[model samples]
Target: MELITSNTHQNQIIEEDHVIKKANGNFIEANTLKVTLEHLKNECIIPVFSKDNESTISHYEFVLKTKEIVQDLFPEFSVSEPDIRTSHIIKGRIPSAIGKPAKELKEHEKTLYYERCAFVMEIPEVVENVNGNKLALTIGGVRAYNQENLFSKKSPEKFKVFIGFKNMVCTNLCISTDGLADQIRVNSLNQLSEAVEKLLGQYDRNKHLGMMEKMSRHEFTQSQFAHFIGKLRMYQFMDKTEQKQCFPISINDSQINTVVKNYYHDPNFSCSGDGSINMWRLYNLFTEANKSSYIDNNFERNVNAYDLTNNLVYSLQNQSSNWFLHN
Candidate 1:
């Protein structure tokens, strides 16, 4: 199916003052405006997924509110892309052979075949042929794993995400945006619970899948932050050093430490300064570990320190994947 996507933004808030103004006349603040948008947009997508596709594993729809990460992934959606590209949905696949989406893979069944059930993204050259909104992903082969669906839309929810106030006005009615959004603060309570639920369900169906592996803060850093895994011994996996030959290169740990320590003192070291690798991925791991960055520079330095490790880590990750799935 060819899915057409478009975006729109304009000023329609001249009357919003009276409707959304505070007692002081400043306007309702950013969060309030954002909450309104979230409710409207979510209403559109969730319904579509629920009604349209019966087997949808998960779904999320929202305006690409953040330019920081969106622009990096898709240059076309650069400032304009992430800034304007609104609404998104992600549905898991139903377990099936290469050509269909019928058999749903249960999570427990997946764990039965592979050494480990890991998530890997695929950098596909052509996207339309792929499922859902995932850029792409690699299912570490285990029969049920490959046969299991990671991205699929079983219901009509596929379009629910696109049915928002902005979408209705901008895309459908061809109207403009209002100034309200600027003042309204929103949150990224970006919920993927449905998706996670499917993953958990899959684990349950397949007895071998077991529960999702709960890595310690250290194990998390090792897995998500590639560069860190090969060098940093966050925690001793399996009593011995988790020495896996997946990563082929060795980095200068002293250099890495210097880079991070030096970045800490630099004023300009925001997360954006990490020089592109897996900054957000690293951030997630640390967040999993319960770390936060109050200062912009520290954020970038730490993220870069974590991202720079992907090259080394993914190698091992892939190698382990090979062991999990037969070539």
Candidate 2:
């Protein structure tokens, strides 16, 4: 698995040209917030009005403002409206915050845990045929509750930029997890534009597609594919060892197995006889698996599942020959 770092690492790689520097010079926090709120209204996620004993106020939160800035950079993609259709309810709890079920606390002592919320913006994809197979650059992102939140006065929300592939014909989301950290991250709004540019660079380079192209040239027998599945299952529940601990995320065995099953058995994954052993087919299988596990309002669950699956795929892709041979 690739070492994941915060988004700031990207600025070091690409030189800050005059355009970005000039934009930064022109950045006015108050004006930016105003512009961002207008964009949120465009997407129909209105700001909430709150009246408390101390004061009465109406304002947009950090999450909504962050969304507006992101949309401004990528005008081509449409923001999924922030309604039930786009929302996810994350499960689980911090044991320390809320004690075991057997214990009960006073009403005022109850903890406040809001459901995890996320938004995904669909990027336009560029598809190409490689050795009679399809390859694409699929891009999207996730902003959520736990990683970064509204409580912090200076830094209120967490935003992640992601890249994946979408099979043109079948429309399955093909995700390659190689260098996962360098591809996604948490960032401050000041670095938002630069971060978006870096992600766009990945899409332009066809980073994931290049890997798939090489894999497509190789062949995998049925037994080898099964062995790959076995490895993923193992990773699904493996303890967090030193080298393998990059992103702090986990997915259970049942969820992992379900995604693997759908990859091979689902009609969307069906390929021509010649397509059976190619890498694109394998990539599609796993990406398909990740997409199939979505549970409404289960934001954190889906995010963890996607991260774990991506890590497994990244590990497998990094040592394809060794893994394929051992199996």
Pick by TM-score: which candidate is best? 2
Q: Report lDDT (CA) for all predictions.
A: 0.23, 0.40
lDDT (tens digit, per residue) of candidate 1 on 1-327: 111111110111112222221132111111111122233234322321233344322112223222222334344532222111111222343244334433655532221111111111122332211001111211110001122233553312211111001111111100011100111111122333232222323322122111101100112221232344333533223334343533222223443343344223322111223322222222222322211221112222222333333332443333433211122
Question: Each model's TM-score?
Answer: 0.17, 0.51
Model 1, residue 116: what's the lDDT? 12
Clashing pairs in 2: 88-297, 89-297, 89-298, 138-164
For model 2, residues 1-327, the per-residue Cα lDDT tens digits are 222212222222212131111122110111111123343334332211122122101112334543565467657765543221122322343456475562555444433222232233334444565434453444444433444333334332344544554454444444444312232343344465456556554553465556544544433445555675576565556677832744443444665576556545544333334323444444444444444333221233333444544444454455533331354
The list of candidate 2 runs beyond 4 A from truth reads 1-85, 89-126, 130-138, 175-190, 202-204, 237-239, 242-252, 271-276, 293-327
TM-score of 1: 0.17
